[model samples]
Target: MSEVGMNKRVMLVEDDLDLAVLIQDFLERYEFTVSVVSDGQDAVTRIIAEQPDLVILDIMLPGLSGMEVCRQVRQQYEGFILMQTALDDDIDQMLGLELGADDYVIKQVQPRLLLSRIRALLRRAAPLQFASSEQQSFDYQFGALKIDLTRRMVLLYGQPVELTTAEFELLCLLAKHCGEVVTREDIIQQLRGLEYDGLDRSIDRRISRLRKALQDDAKEQDQVIKTVRGKGYQLCIR
Candidate 1:
């Protein structure tokens, strides 16, 4: 049964007709509006024109590859990206995250689990989600970046930084654990309510995208998010 019915749309881009149909049919049962596409180029156009609530991308396609699509969307669109692909290689997973994919799911996995993951990314996470509304909202500052949990918006040196729900949640999680290293397992358990995955590069990818949104250099910056060797990550809270 499709659990995510109306009020939201899903962009599904996959070249395989059988798989596409299966996924579309499954999602539609719950009330989700799904726009199906065959390749990455069309996926980008549909995303810009329709602005879906979330995106389900395939790594291998006829043209424009999913990585490029993810990059373009990260630059402009603020929405969740769930990559459903059969590729299980580490390089592919790493590339996907480097390009800003929120979650990666290997094909043929349980649909219920995928649905749970989709909701996890789409759902809001923050200090507000953890606390109450009546409590006076406060701002979190780290170098040039500012997270207004009250407003659920990010600001960098006074400039507004747009983030998809997943990206925002990733940021909030790091900020909440500021100055401490959080492992991929810890992040997945806390954010997605699941155990660590062998292919769980989604959290890392979300963090990379958050850095780009905050204009932090991945190779040469420690102001916002700094990687700890053999550890997770640390948000340099100021």
Candidate 2:
């Protein structure tokens, strides 16, 4: 029964009744308000209407696929979406991220590990608690791009850019170290509090999504976020 989970609403979209009940019970023990919806269409409708703090969405479901539900709900809802996939396939994870999923976990993942991931996502979604006055006052501007650290908002050419929580965090990380290469290990450690396994493509996927939101060409020579060969990424301060 963790106090951190208190008052937080989590909607579980797993279709397996037994599994759903198990997850719901486990999360409830942690003091989170849990809701279960087995159908994708129903999940979308309820999620839009209820607007839970976070959605634990499964890829497979009756009626509508999880991908469709994510796509449709994302158009209207801005809540954190944590996708679940039974397969450990990269395509599923990448596609889900591209479709605005904030994060994903495999169905076979341990319950405690799932809880930890959920906590991590929720922490990121929460308003920043700055540790220093400089951090509290930090904001960045590079040409047409502008990022307000305090407001957690990004503007491109005076237009608001819609970004997932993960994308915004990654962009802020890069912006904070503008013109400096922020390594993969540094990014993973700072953002996830985990070691970079060297195989995890989630960061790359997020960078791709961020680049798209920033209207930066990833393949071009003069990219806003330039990939430094074996090094990580650098935010070119134009």
Candidate 3:
């Protein structure tokens, strides 16, 4: 059992009884407390009530569908959500992220790979522990937008802007390098711990979501975040 998995609660929302049991057993071996909810509605209720550290949510569910469950539970629960889909469908993946899923894994993937994804998401959710706090700035402001890294909060024009964990992290990365183009390769490596395959659209989707939360128009040249054609993205400084 890995010490890092100790005390971590994971809720697996998979309708397949056999698959759920297998995943639960594998995760348990790593010292993670795992709970299984087969119904989407039940998962939402339990997720809100229990607020587990992470949720392994299946896209297809009996009661409410995983997408619906995600939309509903996100109103209250702020924990990490890792969606699962049987097929490698772009629409499903994009919709999952738009609905607040932190990341996703295909059903055919190995259990160990799924475990790796879970660990990556958990690491991102955890607060950064730096040896020297003085070297880092926990707060950043760009015009009407304000980001408080310490509090994991974002405000726009003095009003709180609701953003998922992934969106917030992307925004922070862009803010940290405001006015500088952050390549897709850099973002994938830093945020997802995966090399950019030049085909993954996850980063673009998150950027769109973040822009919407910030009320920034990507079409405008003076937008808060500008797409550097063929390069990546740049957070404009006000």
Candidate 4:
């Protein structure tokens, strides 16, 4: 059992009353203060009003689907989002992450693991004290690649590059620390709110997709993203 004094605040959006109550009870024991809501719309409203530290959002709900709820949360709420989704819905999970959700867990996951996930997310969202202030907004130029964080724009060979939300976030993390090898775990922590057990493949897929949009041709052409075998990834820029 967890001490109430050390409890972290959580907003839970789930339609299943029994599940919701059970989760509240269990998390409370872990020293978490949970505010439960049954509908998606209500969840969205309470998120801004309450400004809780974290949100446990289901993938399906009444009035607004869980996906839509996640979208709304991303647009306004800067807090971490842990999406509860059904098993075997890889596509939906990917979509959720792309839409700005931090991490996803199978609905029937062990309560202990769920708690662990919550803690992990909190640690990631917590700001790094040593992060350079100049890191906030800067223009990085490498060869024909130019990235402007203040303007939220990326250019390759003097051509404007379009990126999805997920891809854009990934690029920012990589480009900001150019030429440095970023481990999959660090990348996952930076891009996703929470971490998954088998997400290295997913991050690779996202990097590949981003590379495609950046006009990186692997064969008979130079590319920006350099893959470090058995290590991670590096963005080599001039």
Candidate 5:
């Protein structure tokens, strides 16, 4: 559970009444103020209006469906959206992610795991606080790689980079610790609240995707994200 007194708001858009109640009760107990919207249309409206910190949206919902709801809410809402999906619905899960969902969890999720995921997403959405006043500005730039933290936009070599939520978060994390070898353990812990189990390749896959997006050659010696052999990854900027 997060520290007391900070009641981060969360909205749960699930059509199943029992599941909604269960999730709501659990989240509230963890110090999050949770609101339940059973219908997808209602969720869209309430989300746009209320602008909660995080949204736990079930993919199968009344009226709009989770995919449609995510698409609509993403247009205006800048906060995180954690999609709830069935294990077999990989296509819908991918679609939701492409639609700007921060992450997706299986529908039959344990409350503790859900809470961990929520905390991770919130951490990613949190601002990158730097000690220097000049570094606190909204825009961060290194050579041709530039990021507008407020706008959540990234540009590489004068071209706009279209990145998914996870990809963007990884890029931001790397940029935040530029020139330092951020260990894989730290990366996974900060990004997902899970310890590196030595077999999880998701972060490595994301780094590959980010390298492609940034046009960085992993084969080259000089690039944005450099693999430090056994150490970890480092973001180097001139």
Candidate 6:
């Protein structure tokens, strides 16, 4: 069944016709206005022109490749990016995150789960849209790290820091519980709507990447987000 009054826009970049059709059909049913581009070059051009709310990108695309597309678009587009690809290798995943992808979903994902991820990203993007005046200004300043929730922007030492979607959400979650330990279980549930089985290391990888972006030297003194050995991660800014 299609959702009512959900006018969120999405751009889907895939070379596979069958898969693209399947995704478009399913998302349209849920009230998303999706635009399709089969090649990376076209994806970049349209993205710059339209500025969709979210972009679903394929890693392997004709012409420029998905990685190239993401790199180019990141320079101008500030919308959410979800990388959906058939290549599920660790290197691919790491590259996607390093290139500023918001989320990475391997191909053959259940439509329901994919839809949930889409909804989650959109929700994070507009967290305080419906909140009261007091709640509307959602900004967190911790030492050199200043987070402007309304603009979905983060700054480190007064310089802008570009964070992927997942990284930003992790920061937000920690800030909401500032000075409290946010376990891995809670992080997985909040970001991916998945239960942490104590085996997945994706969250840890994200933390490492985020630390580098925030200039937190893990080898020296852990201050930004400190690890509690076995418990979880805490955002400590002093």
Report the lDDT tens digits of candidate 3 across residue range 45-159.
8999999999999999998999999999987998899999889776898898878887878885799888877776676555444344335454898887778775566767666
Model 1, 53-135: lDDT tens per residue? 88899888887888888888787777778886686565676677668887777877688876766665555322233334225
All candidates in order of lDDT, best leading: 3, 2, 6, 5, 4, 1
- lDDT minimum window of 10 residues, candidate 6: 129-138
Sort all candidates by TM-score, best to worst: 6, 2, 3, 5, 4, 1
* lDDT by residue for model 2 (1-238), tens: 3434567999999889999999999999888999999998999899999999999999999989899999999988877899999887769988898788988888967999888767766765554443342343337878878777545566676666666556778998998899899999999999889999888877887788788878899888778999887889999965
lDDT of 4 by residue, 20-56 (tens): 9999999998778999999989988999888888898
Give Cα-based local distance difference scores for all models. Answer: 0.74, 0.82, 0.84, 0.76, 0.81, 0.82
lDDT of 6 by residue, 94-146 (tens): 88777878787888889987887787677655434332433434389887677
TM-score of 1: 0.56
lDDT, residue 8, candidate 2: 96
Q: lDDT, candidate 3, residue 149?
A: 73
Clashes of each: 4, 0, 0, 3, 0, 0
Better candidate by TM-score, 1 or 6: 6
Model 2 CA lDDT for position 77: 85
Pick the lDDT winner: 3
State the displacement of the C-alpha of residue 44, model 3, in Å, after optimal TM-score superposition. 1.9
Decoy 6 TM-score against native: 0.65
Clashing pairs in 5: none
Error in Å for residue 185 of model 5: 18
Who is ahead in TM-score, 3 or 5?
A: 3
Q: TM-scores across all candidates?
A: 0.56, 0.64, 0.62, 0.58, 0.62, 0.65
Estimate candidate 3's alpha-carbon lDDT, on a 0 to 1 scale: 0.84
